[model samples]
Target: MTLTLHLDAAGWREHLQSVRNDVPGLVPVAKGNGYGFGLARLAAETSALGVDTLAVGTSLEVDQVRAGGWDGDIVVLTPWSRHDPVATALLGDPQVITTVSRVDDLTTILELNPQARLLAELLTSMKRHGLGRADLPALRSLAPVARFEGWTIHLPMRSPDPLAEARELATAAQAAVEAPVWLSHLPLDDYATLRSELNVEARLRMGTALWLGAPKTRRTTARVLDLHPVRRGERVGYWQRRASRDGWVVVVSGGTANGVALSAPTSAASLKQRAVALATGALDASGHALSPYTIAGRKRSFVEPPHMQSSLVFLPGAAGVAIGDEVPVELRLTTATVDQVVDE
Candidate 1:
């Protein structure tokens, strides 16, 4: 059976409004598993925002968005030199703005299809694709051959400072090209300030903040796969950490496949907070109580590490709980893989 994921349509709409209010001209990011809402739904939702452009991850995803009848400028974030079929996506002029990172790719795009829109990518995080600012002059010099739309920078998710980086990018972009500048994958809070600081016409390709900005708008949950009673002296599981007291051992139908570890930490912490994860991992090593269970709609501590396609959890005396019950799970939609959406 497929795992069930619930989404708050109203909640998502509310979050969308909040983002738009904060950043007047917001470009919502909708790519990859639709951030758990699926592409069709996000395309439909974002189309309602009246935006001229929406960012897709790649060419394959272009069809996913196009199939839904989203008639807008599609900016594919990945570089155009992404293999054959992908590279060919850059050859078409059907409203796709392909990224050109290298000086060679610039000539390749124009030679293949001079009609296509080419937005030069400056080197940023992920270290893949894009020309360096120092090398930007060569590409800018080729603007006459290609239909240069603007400049773009892919900032780091783990960087300590993004605005400063944005400023540097703007300065470098000023030297390279005069077209509108764009950015990909930056924090939502940083956008308005950065856009203000730059004080020019700029665009940001947003994914999480636009789709998963408000936590209450989306949530994920899985079915209780199995349950068993445990005794105080009962020896159980891989690590054998023995039960401190009698309780119920439970299991849920969710693991890595469902984007379990796709997390976005609070604030701008580059690294994840290890306090809870380490404690949970330690419990799994101890091999005593299970970890993935819920009572009265609350997550339970795990007894052991999450196994393939499932996780074990321990429930310590919650009222009227049982097997096969759909427990409430607190998943960060901005960070979790969404399996399904329940329109509300």
Candidate 2:
């Protein structure tokens, strides 16, 4: 038994079609654990959607998508460099496109593969990577040898009115390099609005909102492998913390290695959201953390921190569960690794 992500295949297919139909020039982003469905699975789904281009996080993932039989163009979102020589060599493939954030990187890419398809990333408010608006003019020189596919921008969620900011960035990007702009974090309405507002074509590079768009169609769960009755003050789990009351200690099939007890930095901006985040942090520090796994439709407390491949959950005696039973788990798909993915 293991932590598994079960997908409602029929409903998921419908959602995929609905998204494809809604968003035009959609570049399905299948990157970073493939949004918990794995890269190969997303690649196959992209092919099924008749998409011409798929965006992956790193150059190394290009081959994985190709291996999935997606002959379409694969765009690597991360910038290329000498660090990954093998991936750099893979840039030579006509079907692969690399994102060039710096002028120097553009030079390196050209030197490595003169025919490399390139997407010039514009440095937005994110400030993570990308060339500045002023630097875009310099990229015009490489438009000849290196195939200038388009410009890419990553807008931060905290940006005030993302649509307005996106329009401004799109306008600036066009002045430097007049090409289609590949962007992320735009709602369907905003995407359409931006397209109408600007003369350039816009391609939405989406991951979470695409594959995991409809939460109802995706079900993640961990199987209950073993159970042990425990009394108050009885120690359990790796830390051997004493249970507060009489209950059963559950050995579930997911743990830290599977993304349990792991947390990514929150992007919460509102007052209530920030309050919740702070409270969650406090709860986590107390050694009485809330688990993703739920029993009797109520989230249970973890006996202690998750182990490498398993977690110890404390279920109340009243909420009974047998071995080999499955419990619902709400997890961040981006950070999770499911032992099995049942598509049915």
lDDT of each: 0.72, 0.86
> Candidate 2 — which residues are off by over 4 angstroms?
none
What lDDT tens digits, residue by residue, belong to model 2 across residues 1-344?
68888889999999999999999989999888988998899999999999899999887788788787788988888887778886688777888888888898888878877888888887888789888877867876776667889888888866778888788888887876688888888777998988887777789988888888899988888999899999999888767888899999989998888898688788887899999999998988997789998987789888888888988889887647889999998888889999999988
Q: Best candidate, TM-score-wise?
A: 2
lDDT of 2: 0.86
Q: Give a tens-digit lDDT track for model 1, residues 122-230.
A: 8875687778867877866788677777888888777678777877777878766676778766666676777776646888777876776677655556787777888
What TM-score fits each model? Answer: 0.83, 0.95
Top of the candidates by lDDT: 2
Candidate 2 displacement at residue 24 in angstroms: 1.2
Model 2: lDDT of residue 246: 92
lDDT of model 1, residue 337: 57
